[model samples]
Target: MVKRRDVRNRLLRLFVGVLLIAACSAQAAEMGGKSDARILIDISGSMKQNDPQNLRRPALRMLVGLLPEDARAGVWTFGQYVNMLIPLGQVDAAWKNKARAEAGNIASPGQFTNIEDVIKRSIADWEGSATLYQRHLILLTDGMVDISKNTKKNAASRQYILEQLLPKLQSHDAQVHTIALSERADHELMRTLSRETGGWYEQVNDAEHLQRVFLRIFEKVGRPDTVPLKDNKFLVDSSIQEVTLLVFRKESAEPTQVITPSGTQFDAKSAPQNVSWHRDIGYDLLTISHPETGEWRIQAAMDPDNRVIVVTDLKMRSSQLPSRFVLGEVLPVTVSFTNQGKQITRKDFLDVVNLKSCHTDSNGTGEARPIFDDGQDGDKAAGDGEFTLQVGQGLAAGKVELVILAQGKTFQREQRQLFELADPIPMQVTSTDEGETKVRVQPDAELVDLESLEIKAALVSQAGEEQPVMLLPSAEAGVLETSIATQELLGDWTLSISATGQTRSGTELDLTLDPVRVRGTATPPADPPEEVVEKTPEVQEPAVEPATMQAPLADEPATEEDNSTFQVALFGGINLLLIILVVLAIWIMRRRKQEPEFQLVEEDDQLVEEATAK
Candidate 1:
C-alpha cells in the first residue's frame, strides 16, 4: 500500500508540473512579442508645402494596422508646440479607431518645428509608465528647428535633445528611428539621434516613398529576425572578409544555392568544404570566409525571405580633425586602408580613392574634390592615403562633411568625417573724439599663411550705404588697420573686412560711436575794445523835513469805537465755546448708544440657591 501511494503521489506531481510549464509558455508567447511605440509627426507649416500629397496620414494609418493587437502605441504632433493626440494605450479596435481619426484630423499646419519638446515628452511618457514591451520612437520631420528666427533658443533646443534627452532614452532601452521627410530636414542631427540609439535613419525624398519606409520600420519592429532576402544579389569584392546568407523558412530544411563569381554553383545539401553552414529548425546560416571578388547570387527553393550580409575585410581608419578651422587654412587629412592585416599597396587601388568635401551653411552646399598629397604642401609622404584639402574663397563659413569613397573591382566603401570652418580674421572698430574711426583686423597667426594674406575693408551704414576704406597694413605681423574720417562716421556704420589668401574669409562689425564734436575757434574779445566806462548820472532825492505826529496814551483808549470792537470780540468767543460743548455732548451720547446695555442678571438662580442650601 505504501509503494502504491508513493507512485500515485509522484504521478500527480509530474502531471501538475507539466501543466504549469505549459501555462507559463503560453503566457510568455502571448506577452513576449508585444511592443510599445510612439509616433512623432511634424506638423510645421513647411510640411504643408513640402509634402503636398499629405502622405503622412496614410502612412500613419498603415502603421496602426501593422501594430499587433497586444501592442501599445501613441501618437503626437509637434510644431511650435507638441500635442499628444493619443495617449499610450493598448492597441484595440477602439484605440485604433480613435488613433486613425486623430491622425486624419492632423491637417492644420503649425508655425515652428519644436522637435526637442516632443522628444522630451516621449521620453517622460515612457519612463513614467512601467511595462515589459520594447520601446520605440518613430520621429518624422519635414523641416529642421526654426533657427533662422531665434538662433540661440533653437540651438539650445537641439543641445537639450542631444545632451539631456538622448541619454535618458538610452538608459530606458528605447530606440529612436528618424525619418527625414524632405531635403530641408536636419539630416545630420536626425542621423545622429538614430545611430547613437541603435536605430536606423531613412530619408524619403518623395511622398510616394513614405509608405514604403513606414512599412520597413514596421517590419523592423515586428519581425526583427526576418531578413527580406528574396531575389537579392550581392557583389563580393576582394576587400570583403566574409559573406553570410541567412535563410528563414517554415520548412524543416530547404535547398539553398549560391552561385559564385566564376559561375560555380554551391548547394546547401552539398556545400563545399570552404563553406561553413549551420542548420536549425526553421533557418539556415551559410558563411563563406574570404569570399572571392565577383558577383554572387543567393537563391533558396523554399524560402523567398532570406538576407545576404557582406562584411568587408578592408580596415579603414580616420582621426577626428580639429572641430574648428580658420578660414583660408589647409586641412590635411590622412586615411589608411588595410585588408586582412596587410596594407593595400596597389597604386591603381589607391588611385581609385576619392575624397569629397561638402561644406554646408545657411546659404547652400558647396562641394570640392581634394587632391592626394605626395610629399608636397605639408604632406610628409605620398601614396600612403594622405590628402590635403584646401578650403578656398568659394566655400563659406559652415560645417563640412568629408566623404571618402573607395571602389575596388567589385565593391565600394564610404566613410565620413566632419569639421567646421571659422573666419580667420577677427575685426573690431574704435572711434576717437578727434573724429577718426579706426577698424582693426587681427589674423590667427597659427592658421593664417601671412605671406598670402590680403585684407580689404568697407564701412557700411545702416541705410545700405557702403564706403570703401583703404586698409593700412600695420607693422605687426598679422594686423591690418584702416581709418575712416569723422565726417564719414555717420549713422551706424559696419566695418566689413574681406581677407583672402590660401582661403577667403570675411567678417562684419557695426561701427557705433559717440558724436564727434568740433571745437569752435574763439577770438579774444578784442580786448573788449578798451571798454569805455559809461557812468550814469544818479539823481539825488530831495531831503524832506520830518513832521512830528501826536500819539494817544493808554488812558485815552476809552473811545466809543474801541468799546464796540471789544464787545464784538467777547460775543464771538462765547459762541465758539458754546459750539464746542454741543459737539462733545452729541459724541458722548452716540458712544453710549453704540455700547451694549450691561444687564447684571443672576446666572442660574436655581443652581446658586441649591448650592447655597447645600
Candidate 2:
C-alpha cells in the first residue's frame, strides 16, 4: 500500500509538470501575452557589405535579454546552409546567458542563403493548430533565395518557399515578421511573406538601424506590460512587482540613471540589490524587483525609443493590431483594464479614466489622440469597459508606434505597439520593345473609387531634369495608363510619382510612391531626354502586386474566395497580430489537416551544421 501511494504521487507530480509546460507555451491570447518566437537571420557573404561591423550581434543580444521568463525562442543563421545558432527552449537566465554568449559568433561567411532550410529546422517541433501560444517567426535577410549558383534552381527554391512552405506555416498559425537590411534585399519576397503569413515587414537600408528594428519586433512578440514614461518619468502602481527601463543614450550623454519612488537615485554602477543593469551598444536595460508604487524619474537624455516596462498584476488589455499596414488603411483599436485576471468593467469606476492613442511617426514627433467609450466612431459598443478608436488618418508611411495610455484616479498603465506603414501604391517600371518606358497603375477597386483618382507621373533623368506626363483612363474599367518617351534618354531614369484620389466614401487621399527606375535601351529615340516634354501614368499591367493577395481587414468581410484561404491573424490588433475567431479557427484547423504536409530536406553535414562548430 505504501509503495502504491508513492507511485501515485510521482505520477501526479509528472502530470502537473506537463501542464505547467503547456501553459507556458501558446498562440487565447489577448494581445501581448507570453511569446513563442523563432528568429532566422542571414549571414551570407553579402553581409560583409550590408553589415560589416556586425551590429546584428548587439541587436540579437538586446532581444534575448528583453525576453521575459515565460517566452520560448531560438535563433537560426543561414547562408550556404542553415545552422541552429541557439537551441529553442523556454527562456530563463541560463538560456539568455547562452544566447548572449553565442551571439558573438555571428559572422558573414556562408556561401549561399538557404532560407528554406533554416525555416524548416527552426519549427520542426511545432505542431497542431489551436493552442495557447502566439507563434512568431522573425526572418532577417539582405538577399534573395540563393541555395546554389544555378539561377533556375534558386528560383525553384524561392517558389517552393512561397507555394509549399507558406501554407504549412499558415496552417500552424505562425506569423513571419521579416526585415530587409539593404536596398538590394528582396523587398517583394519579404513583403509577400509578411502579408501572407500576417507578419510585419520592414526595410532597413543601413545596418545601424537593426537594433531599433529588433526592439520594435520584441514589442510585437513579447508584448510586455508597461508604465508610460512622461517627461522622463514613469509611475509604478501598487500592482507592479517589477519595472524595466530601456533608455537610449547619446554618445556624448552622461550615463543613464533612475530615481526610485523613495527619492533614491541609482545608476548602473550604484544600483541597489534588487536592480539588474545591462548597458548595451546604444541603450540601457535596467530591471528592478518589488518596485515601490510611485512615480519614478530618469536622469538621462530624452529619446522616443526609451520605455519603462513592468511585470504587474494590473494590465491595460488591448485589441491586437497588425504590425504592418499600408496608407489608406484605417485600423480600429480597443482597450480595457484588468486587475489580476478579471476585467475592471464598472462604468462608475471607469468613467473617470482617460484613454489615449499616443502616436510617434517617422519623424519622431509625438501626438496624443483621444479614444472614447461613447459608442461612436469606430467603437462597436462602448462604456461596457471597452474604449475604442480608429487611427491611420493623415499618417505618413514609415516606422510608427501607438502607445495606448490609460490613466485612472489611482493607477496608470500603458501598452506600446510598433509598426511599419507601407506605401499604398506599388510602381512598376519596364521598357517597351519600342524603347519607351511604361508606368502602370491599377488601384484596388475595393479600397478606392476609380472615377475620382488622379495620378501624376514624371520621368527624372540622372542629371536632375524632369519631364511631366499626363494620364488617361485605359480600356479596362478601373485602370490608368501612360507612356514616357525614354528612347532618347541616356543613363537610368527615375520615375517620380505622386497621386490624389478619393475613396469610395469620398475621403480625399494624398499618396507617396518610391522612385522606380529603368535603364535606357541605348537606342536613340525620336525625343531627347530633356526635350521629351510629356509622359503620363498608364495601365499597361493589371496588378503591380497580386490583387488577390491584398490583405482584407475585419471591417471588410471577405467573400467565399477570401474565406477559403486561412486569413486573418489570431491575436493581431492597433498594429498588432492574433485575433483568431473560435468557430472559424476550428474550421480552418480541420481544413488544414486535409492538406498535404511539407517534408523538410534530409539532414546532411554540408547542408546543415550547428553554430558551435563555427
Candidate 3:
C-alpha cells in the first residue's frame, strides 16, 4: 500500500508541474505578442551633411528615443557595406543607447556611402528574426547616390537589390517605412518599397519637425487596448450646465473594445474626433474640451460602476479679450470659475495687488513708468468690458508687456505682452481767436501706457504766417489740453498744435500733421454806412429884362440883394412865359407832325405871309 501511494503522489506531482509550465508559457506569449516592431535606420554619407535644420545630433536622438519600450527594433547602417549593429530586440534605454552609440560610430570619420548593401542586409536580418506576422522594417536615408559607373554598374546593381529584397520582404509581410531626409531623395524607390511592403514613407526637411514624426509613429505602434464603460466612471456636474464627450480610434484596424458612459450609444463608423472605447488598449480620448470657464465633469469605464474616473471643470475664465494695447491704460479682465465637486468660490483673503504703472517705453529713450488705472479718474471699472490703459509719453515705442489683475472671487491674473503702442504723428493745432474761445488738442484715439502728449501750438493768419501762442498743459491724462485767450486774436487764424516724437524703433516722424481749429475775431472796416451827394434845383424868376438890358445894368450900381432879386424875378417871369410858349409850340408841332407833311406845310401861316410879301 505504501509503494502504491508513493507512485500516485509522484504522478500527481508530475501533472502539476506540466500545468504550471503551460500557464507560464501562455503568459509569456501574451506579454510578448504586442511589441514586435522593426526599426530600420539609414546611416548614409549624406547624414553627415547636416542638411535638415542644422540639427545633426538632436534629430537622431529623438528618432531613437521615441521607440516603444517593448518594441523590438533593428539598426542597419547602409553605406559601402551593410553594418547590422543590433538585431530585433526589445526597445529600452539600454538598447536605444547602444544603437545611438553605434550610429555615432558608423562610417568612422571618412568612409564611402553605399546604400544598396544596407537595404539587402536589413531585409535579410529582419526576415530571419521573427515569423512573417511579426516583422517590420523601416529605412532612413537621404537617398542620394554618387557612383562612377563604367558599365551601367550602379543602376543595374540598384535594380537587382530592389527587385530581389523588396519582394522577399513583402512575401514575409514585413512593413517597410522609409524616411528620406534629403530634399531630393529617390522618390521612386521609396514609393516602391512602401507599396510592396504596405508601409509609410516620409520626407522630412526640417530636423526639428522630426519629433512630431516620431510621435506619430509611436501612436501607430502603441495599439493600446480599449477601456469599456464598466472599466471607467462617469460623473455629471450637478452645478454647471451641459457637457458632451466624444471618443474615436485614430487608426481603427479591427473591431476593438469600446467603452462609454452608462446609457451612451456607440457608433462604429466614425473618425478621430468621434472615437470612444471602454477598454484601455484602444483609445480613451476626451473629445469634448472642458470649458474655459465653467463647472463640468464626466467619466467612462469598462465596468459601468467602477474602474476609472475623468473629471473636469471650468477653473478659470478671462473676461478680457485676448488683445493688447499701450501700458498705463486701464485693462479690464474678468474671469469666472467653479470646482465641479466643491461648488466653492476659490479666492483666499489677499492684500491689494497694486497694478504696475507705465510698464513700457515708447521712445526707446530708456524711459518707463508704473502703469495703473483705478477708474476713479474716468477709467474703466473692474467688471466693465471696455477698459483704457495709457501708454506713458516717456515709454519706448517698441513691444511692451503688462499683467492685468482681476480682483474677482478667483483673483485671476492675466498677462498681456508685446503690446504695440505706436508713436504719435507730428501735428499742429492753431486757433484763430486765441483770446475768447479756448482751443484744446486731444488725441483722436487714446493710446495704451501713454500719458499726456506734447501740444505745440502756433497761431497763423490768413496771410500764411505763424503767431506764437502759449500752451498750458492740463491735469487730464492722455489729453493734449490747453486754454488760449482768443479775444486778443484778430482775423481768421489757425492754431497749429503738433506732437512730435520718436517712434518705438527710434524712427523719426517728421511730417505728421493734424488739422487745427482756426478761431479769432475779425477787424471791422472804418467806412460810413451811407454817403449823400446833394443836387441844387435851378431857381427861375419872371423874365423882366433881356440880355442887352442886363449888360447895361451891369454898369449901373446894383445892391447884391436888389440885383439878385431882379435877376431872379426877371428870369423867373421870362422862364415862365417861355416855358408856356415852348410848351404850346411843342404841342402844335407834335399835332402837325402827326398829320401828313404836305398838309402841315400848306397850313403854315408863314408860307402865306412870305407869298404876300413877295
Candidate 4:
C-alpha cells in the first residue's frame, strides 16, 4: 500500500509539472501574440572559430540549434562581402538544409570586408523578400574595414557605401540589430550605427553565449509596440545622418520600384541613390544609415513630373524677435512668405507659438492671444481684431519661441518681416527740472551694424496729461540719436523712451523734467520839474524907522492925527499907484486870457519905472 501511495504521489507531481509548463507556455504565447520570433544569425568568418567558454563550439552552430522551431530563421555571412545565406523560411524543413549549406561557406578568412556593401545587400534582400516584419539584422564582426580590393583606399569603399546606402535604407524604415563578436570590430562605430537606427547593441565576451543572446534578442524584437515615426525617421532628414529614402506612392504602403536612367535597378531598400532625369515615370528609393545604431532615413523619389511635385522651400526671418527681450513687449513680428513649390496660387497660414522662460506652454502663459491672422489676405472684417490678443504680463527675459506651421499641402514658402507695437514699453521717465518739457535720447554705445532702432517716448505732466512722442533715428555715423522737443510749457514732465535696437535688446530709459521759474521788480515815473517864485523890493521906509518911529509915538495924539491926515494924503497918492497896479493886473489877466500863454517874467525895477513913466 505504501508503494502504491508513492506511485500516486509521483504521478500527481508529474501532472502538476505538466500543468505548470502548459500555463507558462500559454502565458508567453498570449504576451507574444501571433508574432513569430525572427532571428538573424551572423555567420561571418569569426563564427567559425571556437570560443574559450564553449570548447570546440562554433557560435553560429550553437545559436542555430537553440532557435525555437516555431521561429522564422535566416542566415547571413560576410567575408570580402555579404550574402543572404538563408532565405527566410519555416524552421522545419529547409531551415536545417539552408543552415548546413551556409555553415561551410560562413568562414572566409584572409578576405576583404566590405561592411557597408554587406549591410546594403542585406537591407535589399530583406526589403525585396518582404522579410522585414519582426526583422532584425545581427552583425558580428571581429575586425575593421578590409575593402582594399573594392577601392583605392581601404576605408574608401565603406565610406562610399555608407554615403550611398545608409540614407536609402533609413527612409525605408528598416530597423537593425547589432552584435560585436570582439572589441576589435569597429565596435564603437557599429554600436552607434545600430542605436541610431533603433536597434540594440551587445558585446560578446565568448561566442558560446551567442545562441542565448540571440534568443533574448528575438524575445525583445518580437514584442509588438507602436514605434513613433519621428524616432524611426530621425536619420531621414537632411540635418540627420545615416538616413535613406524608400520611395512609395504617397497613398500606398508598398514601396515603389526604383529604375535609374543609367539602367541601374536598385531595390527600394538600398541607399538613397541619386535621381536620373528622364521623360518617363521611373524613380528611385534611397536608404540612409545613421552614424548611430539603427538610425536611418528611407525616402522615395520619382522622375514623373506630374507625381513628383517639386515645391519651393520655405524661408523665414522676423525682425521682432531680438536675442533678448523683456516680458510682454509687443515686438514687431513681421513675416513674409514666398511660394517655392511647383503648385501656384496655393494658400497657406503661419502659426506663431509663444514661449515663457524659453519653454513652450501650449496653453499660452498669458491672456494675450496673437492678434495676427495665419496668413496673408486672411479675413480682418472685424475692425477691433487688433485688440483681441491677451498677452501675458511679466514674462522672464530670455529666448522666445515662434513656430510657423505650413498650411496647404502643395505649397512651398519663403518669408521675412518688420513690425511695430501700438503699445509703449512701460517705464518711468523722471527729469531733474520739473519744468523741462523736452526730451532727447540716443544709444549710450553706438550699435555697429545696426541701421537704426525704433524709439518712442511718453510724457506725463503734473496735471496728469499723458503725451506720447515718437522719434525715428537719424541716419548718421554715430549713436542713434532722436530728439523730442515739447511746446513751451510748465509743470513737471516725465520722459520715457522705449526702443528695439539691432544690436541691443528691447530697451527703455526714464527721466523727469524740472519746473522753471522767472525773476526781478518794477520802478516809478520821474517827478515833473518844480515851478519858480518871484520876490518884490521893499520901499525906503526903513531909513527913518529908528528916529521917526519914537517921535511920532510921543506926538501921537494930535500930531499923529495931523501926520495921519498927511499920511492919509500920501496913502491917497499911493492909491494912484494902487490903481495903476490894479490896472496892470487887469491888463495882465486880459493878456493871459486873450494872448498865447507866456512864462511869468521877472522884470527889472528900472523897466517897471520906465513903463510907469510912459
Candidate number of the best lDDT: 2
Please list the C-alpha lDDT of all candidates, in the order they appear. Answer: 0.66, 0.81, 0.48, 0.42
**Alpha-carbon shift of residue 447 in model 3 (angstroms):** 62
For every candidate, C-alpha RMSD to the true structure in Å: 37.7, 41.5, 30.6, 33.1
Mind giving the per-residue lDDT tens digits that candidate 4 earns over 1-614? 99999999999999999999898776654433222333333434554453423321234543443343445666655666566676767665358546744655544343655676676666654443223244456666656666665445766765664666655656644446667777667776665556455565677766655654554454344321111133213211122222222222343434544333233444434424343211101223232233232222333433211111111133222222322233334333433333231222222233232211112233333332333433333323333211122222333332223333222233222111111111222222223343332233444342311344455556666667767656544464332333333334344565555555443343432222222221101133579889876766856655542212322333446546686788767646656666777789899999877544332233455578889998
Q: Candidate 2: lDDT of 484?
A: 70
lDDT, candidate 1, 267-293, per-residue tens: 777788768675533456676777777
Ranking by lDDT: 2, 1, 3, 4
TM-score of each: 0.35, 0.67, 0.32, 0.28
For candidate 1, the C-alpha RMSD (Å) to the true structure equals 37.7
Model 4 root-mean-square deviation = 33.1
Candidate 2 stretches with Cα past 4 Å from truth are: 1-32, 362-367, 397-400, 420-441, 445-472, 475-478, 481-614
The most accurate candidate by TM-score is: 2
Q: Which residue segments of model 4 deviate by more than 4 Å?
A: 1-72, 96-110, 126-132, 149-152, 223-614
For model 2, residues 283-323, the per-residue Cα lDDT tens digits are: 88888999887888999988877888888877888877766
